[model samples]
Target: MLSWALTFLIIAIIAAVFGFGGIAGAAAGIAKIIFFIFVVLLVISLVANAVKGKAPKV
Candidate 1:
């Protein structure tokens, strides 16, 4: 999930360097959405682990 966002971000950067405005914008948008989803899931996982009284595995 986070990797996917990073991949999209890289793609956006590359596209922008090549002057692909539409592609860059679309990829950047997708990256942002994926990043937020990853953040939400991470928070939820942490809360679940805390509720179970288990430390998150390192």
Candidate 2:
């Protein structure tokens, strides 16, 4: 999921370089959404592991 966000970010950069305003904007928005979702999921995983009385794997 993090990789997906990065991919979209790269796409946005390339599109912007090529002067594709709409595509760049859309890719950036999608990347932002993916990044937030990834962060939320990561936090949930850490909390769940802590509740289980185990160290998070990393």
Candidate 3:
């Protein structure tokens, strides 16, 4: 999910450089949503692991 966000961010930058305002805006918006979702999921996973009182399997 994070990688997808990064991919979209790169796309946005390239699009912006090429003067594609619409595409850049859309990609950036998608990247933002994905990034936030990733962060939220990560936090939830961490809390779940802590509450379980066990180390994550490597």
Candidate 4:
């Protein structure tokens, strides 16, 4: 998910450099959404792990 956000960020930068305002804006927006989702999921997972006391078996 983070990689996807980075991919879209690169796409947005390239599109902006090429003067594609619409595509750049869209890609930037998507990157932001992806980044937010990644953060939220990470936080959720951390909280869940904190509540979960036992370690998993190998």
Candidate 5:
């Protein structure tokens, strides 16, 4: 999911460089949303692991 956000971010930068305003804006928006979702899921996973009293595997 984080990879997906990075991909979209790259796409947005490329689109913006090519003067595709609409596509750039849309891709950037999607990237932001995906990034936030990823962060939320990561926090939830960390909390769950902590509550389970298990150390995260390296």
Candidate 6:
């Protein structure tokens, strides 16, 4: 998920450099959504692990 966000960010950067306004904007939006989803998933995983009384795996 995080990788996807990063990928989109890279795409946005490239698109912006090439002057693709629409593509850049769309890619940026996708990056933002993916990043937020990744954060939410991480938080959920942390909460679940805490509830299960399990230490984070090394």
Where does candidate 2 stray beyond 4 Å? 54-58
TM-score, candidate 5, is 0.91
What TM-score number comes out for model 4? 0.90
| TM-score of each candidate structure, all chains considered together | 0.91, 0.91, 0.91, 0.90, 0.91, 0.90
Model 1: worst 10 consecutive residues (lDDT sum)? 47-56
Our model 2 lands, by Cα RMSD against the true structure, at 4.6
lDDT of 3 by residue, 1-58 (tens): 9999999999999999999999999999999999999999999999998888966699
lDDT of 4 by residue, 1-58 (tens): 9999999999999999999999999999999999999999999999999998698899
Predicted structure 5: lDDT? 0.99
Worst 10 residues of 4 by lDDT: 48-57
lDDT of each: 0.98, 0.98, 0.98, 0.99, 0.99, 0.97
TM-score of 6: 0.90
Measured on C-alpha atoms, candidate 6 has an lDDT of: 0.97
Q: For candidate 6, write residues 1-58 as lDDT tens digits.
A: 8999999999999999999999999999999999999999999999998889957799
1-58 in candidate 5: lDDT tens per residue?
9999999999999999999999999999999999999999999999998888966699
Candidate 1 accuracy as lDDT: 0.98
Which model, 3 or 6, shows the larger TM-score? 3
TM-score of 2: 0.91
Candidate 2: pairs in clash: none
lDDT of 2 by residue, 1-58 (tens): 9999999999999999999999999999999999999999999999998888956697
Per-residue lDDT value at 43 in model 1? 100
- Residue 16 lDDT (model 1): 100
